[model samples]
Target: MARLDESARGVYLIAVTPFTETGALDLDGCDRMADFYLEAGATGLTLLGVMGEAPKLTTDESATIVNRVLKRVDGRVPIVVGVSSPGFAQMQALTGRVMDDGAAGVMIAPPGSLRTDDQIAGYYEQAAEMIGDVPFVLQDFPLTTGVQMSVPVIARIIKDIPTCVCLKHEDWPGLAKITALRKEGATARRVSILCGNGGVFLPEEMERGADGAMTGFAYPEMMTGVVENHAKGDMERARDLFDAYLPLARFEQQPGLGLAIRKYVLYRRGVLANPTLRKPGAALDPLSRAEVDRLMARLEKRLKELN
Candidate 1:
């Protein structure tokens, strides 16, 4: 693989990995979702992300998904593959596969279960050194990852590996902290920061100086419009776009709703054969599906209002 195009534009959509009715990976569904986002102006595809149910996927499944997506994309858009697991060797192996498959970079969460600050830092330091020339985002998603990478840890990793690039900080107060870090008189060339919460807080993060969004653009109808319009210098339109999606976004916080709802919407949009989820992360049931339909109906009204 040659040098993939580096993401100069900071905003990215953490895409949902659609699945077939038979519980298989849905390549066609993934392609439609990618095209939807890219057409809406997303900068890149952040796949195998927590939003895409990375933890549930086996290492082989993860590698195959990356390869399939890379072949489908054919370099039209850069790929950001998230490798979050307790297994260091697994993370390293996934990173290698992603880099080899022409991904733009890898996003890594803290190592192992019950990782302390030092252990996390050490993991990042070692992982960066091992990854060599590839760029990776240090993703701090404590809600699921069981550990949060702190500011000092963030500072250390970037200082150690300039190629470490940036962070997908899921820490709430992180936006202000990152702003302070950048605004407080220190600078690094290769480092960048991105917003990771599903595009709901983009305006707020932008106000706090977030480099761009790393997640939540999967729904091309509303969220992607906000990120793209905002990037293109239309703040008013961005706010309107975000406001229109807030009612639906309210459910995005519900445990597992993000994936199930996203997959549901893809199914509705004819992007997926069916929303078949793996164990421990089952697809929306009748009740959940009903709620998704209601929310999407409201979202359709909102879309009409926008029009």
Candidate 2:
């Protein structure tokens, strides 16, 4: 597969790590999930993301999942694996392994320890050096990392790191950041911007200059639909599609329960064998599951009406 670069665009779905009811890795379920994402119109795949439950996986397990998905995808689209770690050695090691295993690139999120703008910019500079020539996506998710990256700091990183090719823009109220980055000579060069936060802010992000989304939602078609319609200059159609999924999207954005909700919805959609999160994770209660069911039913109705 070609390396991910500034030209990358469209929905790069952040995939979930499927598990069996017994909590073992579900390789078959991984295949099924890959097929589902591609069929839903994803242009790329980002695995081992935060939503993929990355920290829970041992090194071997992470490699297993990445290889499994890479073989299944068969180079159909670029595969970006998350390699964020507290240390550069681990990040560089994983980057080498996955890049050797046919991954197009890797993603690195700022650790919460970063406080100053210089620290943020310096970290990416060193990371780029440590990872050698491997292209990387700079994950700017202040909500989870608690490390806010202002537009100037982001531009400095882009200016200093040649291999930093994309930004996973997940900062809340971040539309202005996108606008600032796209302004004349804001950075040394252009970098692709893909919005995250499960794509809730994708329409506005795109309007502000994002290329597309790099997030997970059980209904990825809604994301693809929005991007496609927006690219065609059909803002009203894009919004109508977004509105139909907004209820469930908002429901799934719940902090501790988001992944559980996503897994349950995928299982209900017949994409997963089970919705079992690893230990130290949460699961939906019966009432929450029923509520999700109702939302799914309503989404189905709304989609039908739109069609």
Candidate 3:
């Protein structure tokens, strides 16, 4: 198994699941996307995320996608798969299969039913046991999971679960959480903290002690540049590059419309051949596409000025 640890730091792009115009899984596109992300400076790839249309995939389809991504990735970089299921059995099975398929780790978000801190902590304890030593990422994105883990609660989970290695930190206004976790004596062990609000909060998050980012913005090179610049102590350059991409990043962060915009940008950049989304997904309308086109045009101009 590919093990993800605190030493892991950089852009881990949450990949999009592609489909044919007829709604069939685009396995070819998966291979292409894996290669594209790596070449674009992504240190890792996260699959089966919410933006990946995970729930729409059947068990067999999920396995096939994981297998295909691992095969294409071919051990170049770590792969993390989301295994946040309602049942432990399903989570266990998916985690096992993906780990067996060469995944580095699994990401788990608390189920919506979890209310109190005890319920959240207990669920992770049970999940850690079920997964049996597979390193996992605690996805603390409240907007999607509806489970808000306070700082103390997160520290408690880290203290108790040795296998909880990294956090996909997407809590809005989450800089304080990063600060709390990175603060001295917050926890016995320190784990990697990667922000995931579509890279909108990345500059401030990095400034607040986040390791890096793990969001699926269409242009991952933007994230790579920001993280690298920050690590080099070039705060001015990092902020400049981040500002250059901020408009599109903000535009792409729109909830219901974001995925469509991202897929279209990927398609326009030739990373994907088609922008077809699976059923029940939002597709880009003419006006939306035009808006994305304008954003891309302005992004090009701004990037040129920065360069």
Candidate 4:
């Protein structure tokens, strides 16, 4: 098992699930993507995330994708599988299977139905019991999960659950949350904090004491480079590199349209064979495609200037 812990730090690319033009799972493309991420300086890889089109995959297909990716990666970096199911039964089953198949750990987001602090804390308590010693990342993106976890609430979870090792911190304007968590005596113990808003706030998050990123942006090299420079205390170079890709990253992170933009960029880069989403997923319009192309052009120019 990859078993992520507090000491873990650096870029963990939130992987996209590749598919054929007709919408079937692209197992071979999954292999290519794994290789591309590792070569681009990813310290780890997380799959079946929201950006991976996870909810769209059936159970069998999900297992197949995980198995394929793990095989291709072959333990070069930790592979964290997103096992956020509505039911603990399903979550437990998936976690067990993936761990058996060599995943390093799993990620869980609080159910959207959770509201009050107690409800949220209680839910994770049950989740911790169900998963039983399998390390997990607590995903804290209130925008998507609809369940906001206050700093105290998160501290409580960390205090109560020993296996909760990292956080996928995607709360917008979340720099303060990072600051709060890193404060002395906040959490019972230290846990790795990785922000995930498409790398939009990565520089600030890094400054606020985040470990690194676990977001899906087409140019993961940007995330890797920013984190590397930040670690080396080269703030100027980090900001410059982040700013160069900010335009494309902002364009690629348009909520409902973001995945289409990311997949297209990956396909255009030869990492994905075809930028096809599964059924019920949207495709980019010609106007959107044109917009992405223009952004990509600007990104190239800006990156050259930075260099």
Candidate 5:
């Protein structure tokens, strides 16, 4: 597989880790999930992300999932595994293992302990040194990580780290940041910027110079539709497709319940055999499930009307 680089684009779905009803790793379900993402028009896959329940898994379990999905994907598209850990040793170890196992690249999110600008910049310098030539996605998700990366700081990192090839832009109200980073001479080199936050701001982000999305929205076709149409200079068509999925996208953005909603929808769509999340996770109640069903029905009706 080709290494992920600045030229990367399109929807890179942050894949969910599938589990059985007993919460065991579902290797078969992983294969089914990989097929579903590719069939839905994903250009790449990001596994072991926060959405993939990374911290909950043991090292062996994480490797098992990565290898399973890599074999299933068979180098069809670039696969980026999140290797954010409290220690650089673990991150380096995981990066080496996955890269050896055919992964294209890895993602690193700043730990919440990082506060000062120098601290943030120094951390990436250390990380890049530790990983040693492995291309990495700098995940700038302030809401989840509580580590705010200013545009100047981001530009500095991109300028300083040659191996930092992409930015996972997940900061809320971050469209301006994208514009800033894209300005001429903002950095030594331009890195691919893929927006997150479930892709709710993808249309605006693209307009602000984002390459595409790296989110876990269950209805990925909506994301692919938006990106494709936007690239074709069809803003109206892009927004029309986005509006159709907005309601469910908003519903799934709810904190603590988002993953459950996504898993349930995937299961209902026959992408997963079970909607089970591992322990220390939340599941939707009966009423919430029914509400999701209603939203899905409405989405179907809206899509049909659009067609």
Candidate 6:
């Protein structure tokens, strides 16, 4: 059993929730994707993060995915469930629901459907009050949330809730501000700054002494190699792998094509049923499909070359 306070061991993969052709939750695909990451040697899984289509998923649906993932993993790895909503009450309720259903940790994005520091703080404050003893990882993806979680805001959260053990760092260069917050390395070990925004920024963040990342679902090798090997003085091979994967990783984060490309690649590789997602997720049109296919073909050829 994963205790709420159990320290995260290494870089975890943030899974992309898969769907079937008719927009049904692809439970089997979900299991296969999670298994792929674990077998690739990922430390744990940060489920329903920004990439899991959290904003688009219903609370009950999100809980169901977590429950299914829990069964599939069977305590082999910790599952950090993201249970965020627009308001504090909803966040608390969702957290309670997930915890009651047996999630290991509740990762929350900043307040949604609004844009103000006080509003954000109030949401989080109420969230802390509502969900005691639940471990929280503050998310800072402004693209997902309307506002950035500034240093002062984070400091406020830390002051109020010491159990907020991690901050999923997707802020552009917030690491610099974060590094400045170190009072005898308070920023380093006191709280974990998980590398979000894909593993692209991970090398730089690790170089600057940021903790591990909740990198993408498909490519656990990239983060695992960097953390376990590169961070541990195996720079030579790490550089080689990083160089080879840079293009593919860059393509993975391209606006609009992100999910479509990942699903297409997984489909081509025969791991996914199809390149499908829940509605309002913006699937590829003809032009977008052409772009995805081009990039995927390059990635596929490159993978074979590496072999």
lDDT of each: 0.72, 0.95, 0.91, 0.92, 0.95, 0.74
The clash numbers for all candidates, in the given order, read 0, 0, 0, 2, 0, 0
Q: Write the per-residue lDDT of candidate 5 for residues 135-222, one digit (tens) a residue.
A: 9999999999999999889988998999999999999989888988999998889899999999898899999999999989999998
Q: Cα RMSDs of all predictions?
A: 2.5, 0.7, 1.0, 0.9, 0.6, 2.6
Candidate 2 deviant stretches above 4 angstroms = none
In terms of lDDT, model 2 sits at 0.95
Q: Clash pairs of candidate 1?
A: none
Question: If ranked by TM-score, best first, what sequence of candidates would result?
Answer: 5, 2, 4, 3, 1, 6
Candidate 6's residue-wise lDDT over 119-233, tens digit each? 7677777777777888888777887676767676777777677668777778776668557544464432467767777788666676665667876835667778877765577
TM-score of model 1 vs. true structure: 0.89
**Candidate 1 segments exceeding 4 Å error:** 1-8, 112-116, 186-190
Candidate order by decreasing lDDT? 5, 2, 4, 3, 6, 1
- Candidate 5 C-alpha error for residue 124, in Å: 0.6
Residues 153-176 of candidate 2: C-alpha lDDT, one tens digit per residue? 999998888899999999898888
Compose the digit string of candidate 4's lDDT tens values, residues 29-107.
Answer: 9999999999999999998999998999888888889999999988889999999999999999999989999998999
Q: Estimated TM-score per prediction?
A: 0.89, 0.99, 0.98, 0.98, 0.99, 0.89
Q: What TM-score, to 2 decimals, does candidate 3 have?
A: 0.98
> Which pairs of residues collide in candidate 6?
none
